[model samples]
Target chain A: MSSLVESTVQETSHAPAASVQSASLPRLGMAAPAFEAVTTHGKIRLSDFHGTWLVLFSHPADFTPVCTTEFLAFAAIAPELRKRNVELLGLSIDSTSSHIAWVRNIKEKFGIDIPFPIIADSNKEVATLYGMLMPGESKTETSRCVFVIDPVGIVRAMIYYPLTTGRNTDEILRLLDALQTTDKHKVATPANWKPGDKVIVPPPATMEDVEARLNAGYECTDWYFCKKSV
Target chain B: MACISSQGELSESARKMLAAMDASATPEDVASRTELPLFRVRAGLREMAEAGLVELNEEAYSPTQLGRSLLTP
Candidate 1:
């Protein structure tokens, strides 16, 4: 990864675009694909977000009604996300000027400033890297996708929603909370789990463990199921 | 250690430890919870103790009220 970063700095032609296009979408529990692009905030690299959990999401385009509503929703939760040590980065196949104008329009009309950076990926370099382009949806526009990246840069969670339907931002925040909770407690979240809810413990692996789990005082229906507050 | 939290003022490791910690967490317990190494957990506990974020009771450690405040918004 250091070599990739080094070559990216030393030469502009080292990472071939053809090779980039061939790469598959990043898998969960694997490192996220790296790229740098001009953003509304300024020139920035993916590495700039190292050491922090990042929500890297892409929309079909900016200034569209659905995308505008999503941006405002994301903006409303910016401070809460910051409290959890998470940073938001948005992307689309739009130019920097267009991104800036859209941001300004959002601010002027909605009276809400987007607190995060929006990557201006005009050349589709980044769009292809993350498999954001869905020809079934639109060749020129990116699909609405979200990648929840951990502090160590792994792609922990991914979600894709159709362009016509708006995304539920609360679920994004809930997913982040679940991921962080799992990391902090080594526990799994049950369906529709929320903060302060009892976390699911790992099931027993052997007979002795199973015997112990039953007598271990967790709220268990059987050796295979257990829940406890961390 | 860097004061990583603007509100808690605890270092990053300390905050991680406190967030994962219950009233009766051992160093190994917290190490697994935070996914931090035991050595770092021990060091972070010491930092927390020094800052009064946590207190040693019996063999387990618990957070002070001041520390609990940091865990909330």
Candidate 2:
């Protein structure tokens, strides 16, 4: 038991993008913009992933060193991601043939098959739709951007990295674990939290709730910062 | 209409609308899930209901077997 305080939460909407039809960067907690594009697996619509979580990521271009390493890393974790019901969709301002050539090259050389489809965004339609392009980095290439969309098509999280650095697949999986855990348990995860770790109990909204929280059996650092296992 | 081509595949908009549906959902839920405008979802649901692909129960819509055939199993 410890000192208690109360807080307030403002109701926010994550579903309004009725006027979003341009290439602007999408904000967090907003509905993901839609698009249709050609892929290594043929044409696909953003709607095609309605019931599944999607990792819509972009790299600089095919055949680039950093991007190649990323494909290998993603390939290594594709099976693990599928076990979590998350689909991987890659994008770049490159042609389908180039994607094919690069993927085939990776398979022939690195002996790893890229199980996911790579979007051939030569026209930049889908790339621009999700604002994957960073003009400051390169005019024609999409930067290393990742957008994690949930089952209902909401953009739950995004990460932007420079073209020079490859991303960490473990961190992506950890983020997915955190999001799904939060959804199921209705609690927030602490910094660097992983599976089987203590989750932060949502803070009390009133003084009475705060008082109840102290005896509520949580490991209370304070009422506002309690931890519990789901 | 444009919702169904001669090949019998659903139009992109119809597919999007249908993909957003589960056992039962309101047009508003479908709209937000697909990120399509509400008006389009309303119209699409009406059209799907007329085509026997979905059914209306008061304000909610549910996909029929025919509609389920078009989506991932």
**Tens-place lDDT digits, model 1, residues A2-118:** 112333332223333423322457777766776766666544566556567889999999889999999999999888888897889899989877888999999999999998878
Off-target runs (Cα >4 Å) in candidate 1 are A1-22, B1-73
Task: Report the error of model 2 at residue A164, Å.
Answer: 0.3
Error of 1 at A218 (Å): 0.6
Model 2 lDDT tens row, A1-230: 01111110111123455245223456777667766566775555565566678899999999989999999999998888877878899998888889999999999999999988788888777777777788888879998999998877778899999989899999999999999999899999999999999999999999999999999999998779999998
Clashes of 2: 0
lDDT, model 2, position A85: 76
Candidates' interface RMSDs, in order?
Answer: 13.1, 9.6
Please state the error at residue B68 of candidate 2 in Å. Answer: 19
The CA lDDT at A47 in model 2 is 59
